[model samples]
Target: MSNENVAILMSTYNGEKYLEEQVKSIISQDYTDWHLYIRDDGSTDSTVNLIKKIARDNEKITFLNENKPKNLGVTGSFMDLLANTKAQYYMFSDQDDYWMEDKISATLRKMQASEIDHMPICVHSNLTVVDTNLHGDSLMNSSEEHWSDFKSMLFANCVTGCTMMINQELKNLLDFDKVKSNKLYVHDWWIALVAAAFGKVVYLDRSTILYRQHQGNVIGSNKKTTLFNKNEPFNGRVIRMVKITSDFWQAYGSKLTGQNKNYVKNYASLVQHRNPLWNLRIVLKYPPARATTTGNLVFGSIVVRDYQKLSRLG
Candidate 1:
């Protein structure tokens, strides 16, 4: 450990195309005191070779390629890399994306000062996406204006991975080992749901990177403008969401009790299938709208009548 202020947890799989460039951008950051825990998911290509070369060449870069015999896929590989970091703040990184110079600095500042607990997950920022060489807004930041923004976490995900930075408060609760067992989801949704359950999630209104969107992504960038593509229909979106929310409750059920569990189950339903329970939640609690310092509370308690409502799964 070099007494760094931040550690970047990066996972790669066949990322030779942009791996060198991404590494270059990180190494060029003005904030020099940081460690990068880079791991390859048993890539057969030159990707692993490049990582080895990088580890040999740079002191700040540390490689974690010892994840057993076979590749762990995306989620498992990332989790394996993440479990190896020990920094005051940890930020998730993808193989193809490059971070802005101030990315770590800005997120680390907030993490150190944040009053929230690890139970609520972590805080994240906005992203500016790049399509091929041209750039445009990912339009995720504008999600803050959604009608159901606060109440509709299940309906849509507003958080982006490149923009995430977790504090020690969150770090303590996040058993990186445990996430590998939760079969579904990329790391972003996992963090968002966990954080929102315990407390409010703060969104920094800054674009942290050039979120390169391409067809090669395991889960392509969730940019608003890209919705016109027919392959990216909304039917699968709702189903994938339902699965994600349901899995969250199932995996972390024991950690929650009391109204928190009730709220999570109810809220998850409200989000996954638009179960009328959300509106009912507002009625049962007898408060139309209540505000917490960071997140607002809508207490509607309508029992879910239909459990079989189906949607096209993503």
Candidate 2:
């Protein structure tokens, strides 16, 4: 290759069934200034061997073995890979998903063109969720506003990890060492939140990936599995609520850095008090990013005139 400007960080764990197809799709990209920085997290199958076979012949794909005595899980694997890269642009990839051809080109264009490129703006796209057999089942879409930067950055995950493309500064800032490095990372939720606080988050709605969902997924599908599906619930809604609220409170209140620390503190406080006024203010105050937040929190409905204006843009 002539150069290496983009670094693709992919994390794989027991993904043999779909690994080859996904890897082939990545290699088929129209863009040439890129390399696949991959780490296979102790697969018991021939998945690592499959990667090693192709990687041996292709210099662009660098296969990093887990040097750790134990598997670091997905977050630690990414941390390790992120530290090892020196590319201008950084992205995270899921093992089982196939990216659209224009995915990187579109993200790179927006990133290179944005005035806030120095800041972390997450350029994401719409994803079509598919079954194991690659049949389209649902749409795992992107956020319309900058809220994915805020809300996802705050409590719950609003954006999918696979559809994201972040910048260099964004990568450096969110890396564990830059700010709040000591906290345990629940994969990329903290990283996205930090990204929103520091940079602008863009929603590129073009469908750009085939996100495959199966029972083994860390965060499985929202719907029940089909015929072979275990489709088991994580208990009832109330029990799920208990854990979710706890996670939100902790992530939001934890000693975070940059602008989010303040926002998180305020949010945790508001939710603790069970106040409607806070959401109302959030709805009224933040624009573009918090449209849904406002509509859901503040007035049950937006002012008709404002809603109509936003609708036209959509």
Candidate 3:
């Protein structure tokens, strides 16, 4: 693989503590044919200075939006990075996580094996969950029975951006300008939806990166479950899920296929209908395939019980 074929995009914001370590891990990757693009999202700390110093030493590392720090949030920063860079393959990087040596090579291999001519494809792997000190026994597996289904992806996203490598075809399909930052919940979820709906979402069941869990993490891994938290109130979880689904539908519903469009439309409209029975019927007809059976049951119950309240709030 040529250096120009692979681009790793990292968006940094107040990640001074772990940024250097993470960058070092990338620099030590077994796959050396890759370029690193770092964009600072208005950091108050020495993150920019650190990046500049490192870029000075390494020719492959390039700092983006230097000196001019626009505070595009996480999703916006990543979308901006994606929009600016062109490559045969693109990988997203988080400043806090450490990549395994073979992370790039393994993910690229899987992507190459799964590629189809002119079709958008995204390949992502599981992560080894680690604490701030990079110690952990658990794995953040990125697999669900129905994760590849468009309807399932609308309800829950199993893809993690830091572990993802998307091809040029998938990059072309992700139009950042079409969907505003607010409506798009997260960049990874939006990309997963696009891959599920239009092309292929290939999941590699192996761990590729050290997924660091810390206080400042925008999104963290949960050892118990990825879809829903058992401790949170059922209605609150259902409402949040509904809102995200509605946002996804509002953003890209029109671009989906006829069946998927109706599926998303019905799911997003659950809060609009106050009738519990109607909501129950909809849930029964088009159930979101959650990771676990308990999740599906809880989701169904909450949608039925809180339909009226959800409508009132909306």
- Estimate the TM-score of every prediction: 0.74, 0.69, 0.88
- In order, the Cα lDDT scores of the candidates are 0.62, 0.60, 0.82
Model 1 Cα displacement at 308 (Å)? 6.4
Give the better candidate number (1 or 3) by TM-score. Answer: 3
Q: Per-residue lDDT for 132-166 in model 1, tens only? A: 56366665557543221233554456677677877
Give the runs in model 1 whose Cα sits over 4 Å from its true position: 1-4, 66-69, 116-121, 134-140, 143-151, 176-182, 225-235, 257-260, 266-314
Of 1 and 2, the candidate ranking higher by lDDT: 1
lDDT of 3 at 57: 95
TM-score of 2: 0.69
Which ten-residue region of model 2 has the weakest summed lDDT?
234-243
Point to the candidate with the largest TM-score: 3
Tens digit of per-residue lDDT, candidate 3, span 41-116: 9999998899999899999999988967898888889998999998899999999999999999999988888987
Stretches of candidate 2 exceeding 4 Å from the true structure: 1-4, 66-69, 142-153, 178-185, 221-262, 266-314
